[model samples]
Each structure stands twice: as C-alpha cells, then as structure tokens.
Target: MEHHAPTTEFLGMTFNLSNVLMITIASAIVFILAVVTTRSLAMRPTGLQNFIEWVMDFVKGLIGSTMDWKTGGRFLFLGMTILMYIFVSNMLGLPFAIAIDSELWWKSPTADPTITLTLATMVVVLTHYYGIKMKGAKEYGRGFVSPLKFLFPFKIIEEFSNTLTLGLRLYGNIYAGEILLGLLAGLGGAGIAGALGAFLPMLVWQGFSIFVGTIQAFIFTMLTMVYIAHKVADDH
Candidate 1:
C-alpha cells in the first residue's frame, strides 16, 4: 500500500503538521517552565530557585570566561534564554519507550530551516542594534570602513555570511538527523527482515543524532554570545 503525505495549513501557508505541533508544544513548555521557575524568589534558594540559580551561574560562567563580567552580565539573559530554548527544542524529539507508530512528531523546530533562520536573523539584528547603541552611529558606520575603507564590501559580506552560517549549521544537522531517522523507519516498516537490517544502524544514528543536537544547541548559543560580545566589547 502506498501512503500519502500529510500537509498542514495555517494562514494560507503550508507546513508539516508534525513539525508545527512539535515546535508549538516545545515553545509552550519553555514559556511555562520559565514562568514557574521565576514566579517566586527565595532568600535562601531551594527547589526551582536553586535550579534557576544554577543555570544562571552556568551561563554567567560561559560569558564571563569568554568576556569581561561587565559585558557578560549585560547580555547574560539573552544568552541564557537562547540556550534554554534551543536545548529544550532539540531534545523534545528524542525517541522514548513508546511504540514508534504511536509517535506523532519526529522532528525538532531547529530542524526546520525557517525556524532556525528566523532565530539567526533575530540574533544578527540584535547584534547590529547593540553595536549602534554601544558605538554610536558614527563609530558603527566606521566599522564597515575600518582598517581600509575599500574593505566595506567584504565587511558587509562577512556579516551576511555569519547569519547564514549560524542558521544553516543548525538546520543542516537537525534536518539530516530527521532524514536518517526516516530512512530507518522505512526499513523497519518492512517487517522482521527490515528490522534486522535497520535496528543496529538506527540505534547508532539515534545516539549520534542526540549528540549532534546537543552540540548544535551549544554552538548556536555560543555564537550568539560571541556576536553580542563582539558588538558590545570596547575593543571592536
């Protein structure tokens, strides 16, 4: 029997329903967790406060190590929020003990180029905003002409390339992972013979995909911090 693909439409735009739902659910979970974690502040930390504090410290350390405390503290919230959102979204698609057929969603939001590109665009725009805010319009404009005014085109190209790389790197990794899983599932659908052919490879790929997902999240977060730091740093 041949299977027809499913399509979802919203606002006249078509998207894979599974991908849309998974991203929506993940975003909701992140928002709820953020609300719950920050609703109460304790003088002596416990429970959610302790967990929140630990995550803050971890992000603080990452920025502090890469940059000065003053700059790091300034962008700490942005960095932490990006890291948490991506990390949770990446892990949301992990396979569980439930039967594979029962699983409705099989890909993470970061796997979608549209979602990742939107995030990358936001980061790039924020970098420009902070750059202008910190350096003033004159100095910020001078950055394009720095070292040699003739290099302005190259600088502009570099900025565009940074945003492209930030988005594509994440989308490529997660999309490839999803493709590999789909291939494995196709093989597994062929019954006992296919299960034998697919199981070991599926196991290895799943494990490696999880690893890649985690590393991609870290890379995205780190690049975001690096971009902000470059923008806000005193030394250009």
Candidate 2:
C-alpha cells in the first residue's frame, strides 16, 4: 500500500501543509468574492451580484421549505455561509495545485474528518444553545424526560448519537469521494500503460466526485437547518 506522505509539521503536530494552504486560500477567495459581489448592490442586479443573490435566494427557499419562514429567516446567514463555504471548498480540489514535483494538493477540506467534525460540532452546540434559550431550562430538561421520565439515560444517548450522525454522514461521503479520487490518481501513476488506461476512468470519476461534493454540501446545510428548527420550534 503506497501512501502519500504528510507535507509538513507545526507546533508538535503533524499538519498536511497542502491541505492547510488550500483551506486558507479557499477561505480568502470566498471572502473576496463575497465582498466584491455585494460592494455595489443595484436595484437591477447584474454580474456577480446577481449570481450571488440568486444563490442566496435559492438557499433561503430551501430553508423556508423545510421550516417556517420566521425561523428559517433567522438562519439565513448560517445557511448562506455554509453553502458558499462548502461549495467553494468542494470546487477547490478540482484544479489540483502544483507546488512540489507532480504531487497533488488542495483536496476538499470537508473531505477531512477534522474539518467536517469541527463544523458538525459547531452546529450541534448552536442547536443546544438555541434549545436552552428558546425552551428555557425547565422545558429543555423536561424534553429529555418526556413520555418516559425514567429513560433519562436513553435520552442523553440519543442526543449524542444525533450529533455524531450529523458529522459522520458528511465525513463519510466526502472522505469516500476523496479516497476514490486518490485511488484513481494512484492508477494514473502506475507506469505509462497504466497512466493511459486510467485517463478515461479518471475523467468519469472526477465528474462524479464533483456531483457528490455538491450534494453533500446541500445535505449538510439542509440537516443543519432541520436541527436548528427542531431545537427552536414550539412543538418539538
């Protein structure tokens, strides 16, 4: 089994330099695009501003469809940020960066468990915060004990499982896609004949990977909206 070596280390931790650089670069690109897009808003939007607005509206509609507008409206920023960030990050790996030798860099950040899990944890924590705020301590506590007060243990387990699944699902899909891409790249490196044989298959895989990446981003955002809605809803 040939494994690509880690790029670099920092502060006693082994960090993949390429991944870190790619994430930083992707974040900056998104930030700049966002700033440029909204800098000159118009009554009749055009160019990048129009595209950005369209995407935002699309995300808003998705949220509205899942939950009431009042609740969904409040989460517009969250949904927009997640969708744009994930979309940009997913597309970042499409043009593999070249820095050292023929080594590929700039894989999707969400494909990494560390990145996906961090985002998932934030969503889970936000859900809990809103749950406590909206329902109050008393009702929040009561929610855990509803139907069967004696099942407090099971309720706690369920809460953790929900969050775990939220993170794991995104991680699994993105990671598997990344792994398949890596495997395809490996085939391309297996001498000249292998490289020639791998081209068509590689193209197919790359196209499929793009589709998978986009769907994963949408699913993650939808789930986030659902979780937050459930937390803040009166009937939950």
Candidate 3:
C-alpha cells in the first residue's frame, strides 16, 4: 500500500500533518530529556547524569577539534542539541511506522527532504552569522576574495553544494532505510514461512539502521562544526 502524508491547507500554505506531528514529538522528547538530565546537579554523577555528561563531553571534543575552545565553547550547547535531536528523530521510525487510512502519520522526520534541508539551511545560516559576528562584516566579506579574487564564484557555488549535500545525504540514507524496513515488514506479515524468512533480515536491517542513524547524526554535527570553523577561524 502506498501511504500518503496527511496534509492540510492553512493560510494558503500546505503543511504535512505527519511531519509536523513527528517534529513536535521529537522536539518534545529532546526537551524532556534535557530537563530530566539537568533536573539534579550531582557532584558525583551516575546513571542518566553520567550518560548525558559523557555525551556533552563528546560534543565538547568535537568543538575543540574544529576551532579553539575560546571560540567553540559557545557552540557546545548547539552541538549537543543538534546531536541529540537528530539522533532521536532518526530512531523514531526504526521500531515501526504508523500509517492510518493511507496516510503516514509517523516516521523519522529526517527522512523527509523538507526537514533535512531546513536543518542544513539553518546550520549554514548560523555559521555565516557567527562568522560575521566574530570576524566583523568587512573581514568576513573579504574571505570570499582572499588568496585570489577568482575564487569568489567558486566559494558561492560551494555554499549551495554544501547545503544540498548535507541535507540530501541524510534524507537519502534515512528514506532508503525506512523503505526497505517497510518492505521487510510486509514480508513478515505474509505467512509463517515468510515470517521466518523475514525475521533475521528485518532484525539485521533494524540494527544496521540504528547504526546508520547514529552515524548520520554525528556526521551532521561534525560537518556543522567544521563549517563554522572554516567561517570563524583566523587561519582559514
């Protein structure tokens, strides 16, 4: 069955109800996790606190590797938030997807090009904003012409390419994973023999999908920091 997204028209604009609902759920999950993780500050952390601290430390390291701590420290929260949110979003569809009356109501938001592209655009925009704020507008604009004036057009092209690749890479991986998983699910429902045959492949694919989702989250966060470093670093 081909399930279509439930959408609505509002203020002369179209909106995907499924995407909106999933995005809201993902955001709420991230928010609740953050609150729970920080609800108590312990001098000696354990359990969830320890886990979140470790994740934060990992994000800190990512920032440090890209730019000096003085500059990158400010982005620690951003990096951590991005990592956690995208990870949660990626994992949402792995368990199972929900389609109600030919409308897909639940899935990974990152599987949609609209969501991924918006995220990429936001990250790229933030990098430029920070670059201007740190380097001053004049100095930042000079970046396009530095080393050689002819590089300006190429640099402009690079920005567009970066945004397209960053967004499409995530969307492609997740969308394909979900499609295959859906097929496997259909196979599992066929009959006893089909269930037996599909079980192992489904299980294996689910695990691989988890791995891919985690990698994609990390890659997106890493690239975000790298882009910011290129924009804001003095030596760049």
The most accurate candidate by TM-score is 3
Clashes of each: 0, 0, 0
Taking all chains together, the TM-score of candidate 1 against the true structure is 0.83
Residues 1-236, model 3: lDDT tens digits: 79888999999999999999999999999999988998887999978898899999999999999999999999999999999999999999999999999899999999999999999999999999999999999989998888799999999999899999999999999999999999999999999999999999999999999999999999999999999999999987
Clashing pairs in 3: none
Error of 3 at 108 (Å): 0.3
Tell me the TM-score of each prediction against the true structure: 0.83, 0.86, 0.98
Cα-lDDT of candidate 3: 0.95
TM-score of structure candidate 3:
0.98
Stretches off by above 4 angstroms in model 3 are none
lDDT per residue (tens digit) for residues 5-98 in model 1: 2467789998766667777877788888888988898799879988888888988877876679976787888887887888778776556212
lDDT of 2 by residue, 173-217 (tens): 777776776777777888899889888888987798788778878
